[model samples]
Target chain A: MPYVKIELTREGVTREQKQILIKGITDLITETLNKDPHLTHIAIQEIDLDNWGYAGEQVSVLREKGITADKK
Target chain B: MPYVKIELTREGVTREQKQILIKGITDLITETLNKDPHLTHIAIQEIDLDNWGYAGEQVSVLREKGITADKK
Candidate 1:
């Protein structure tokens, strides 16, 4: 059983996006790792901005300073 | 870096319980795997019953059929 977990900031991601993520990950695992798509379990965790930290600062605080994790 | 993800049904789990889980898992990994607690990341995912599947059925369906996953 291949279990894949994706954690992201709770940035208003839709249910359809989550479905696509689950399906895409399952397909990738099946193709590369030879895992069964039916047995693959994928979970997406949408963490709160205050709960997620990076570089010793909370995401919420970083956002206040116009800093973000996105590469743009 | 050690990353641990815990997934459970969205069944009224409190924030305190999640804190406990994160701390406990970090300690366990530090002690057993010699991982640094500072480098350990723990995430808890609360999933909807209809989104989690087991045994060819969703958890919501299993609950309706009186087939609970909890071990007594």
Candidate 2:
């Protein structure tokens, strides 16, 4: 069994998106590792900007400065 | 900052329990990793028995068979 966790800023996330992410991650893991789909566990977590940081600066602060950009 | 994810079976979990878990994980990361509490991220996820497996058997099946047990 494999456990995976995906964490991102909580600006916008929908139930449908979460569903897709869970399925895609599961499929990727199963395909790559040859593990059973039912045995793969994927959890997606949205972190508030204030709780996420990069380079010793919180994401919220970087957002205010317009220096933190997400690619994709 | 470090991100920590805790995954476990979802049988009985309370909101209060989750709070304790979050705090404990964050504190541990902050202390051990020397990361700031405000920048540390901790997400706790509970997986359904049907989704988690061990030894090629789903946790639900093991539960039914009384072969899977959690310590503490």
For each candidate in turn, the interface RMSD (Å) is 4.2, 6.6
Candidate 2 lDDT by residue in tens digits, A5-68? 6777887776556666666777777788899876766655568999998899999999899885
Model 1: per-residue lDDT, tens digit, B1-72? Answer: 987777888878898998898888888899999987889998886897655544334556668889886789
> What's the TM-score of chain A alone for every prediction?
0.89, 0.84
Q: Note the clash tally of each candidate.
A: 0, 0
Per-residue C-alpha lDDT of model 2 across residues B43-69, encoded as one tens digit per residue: 877865654544434556668888757
- Could you report the Cα RMSD, in angstroms, for every candidate shown? 6.9, 9.1
Candidate 2 matches the true fold with a TM-score of 0.52
Q: Model 1's A-chain: what TM-score? A: 0.89
The superposed Cα distance between candidate 1 and the true structure at residue A30, in angstroms, equals 0.8
Q: Docking category for candidate 2?
A: incorrect
Return the clash pairs for model 1, or none: none
Docking quality category of candidate 1 according to DockQ thresholds? incorrect
**The candidate that achieves the highest DockQ relative to the unseen native structure:** 1
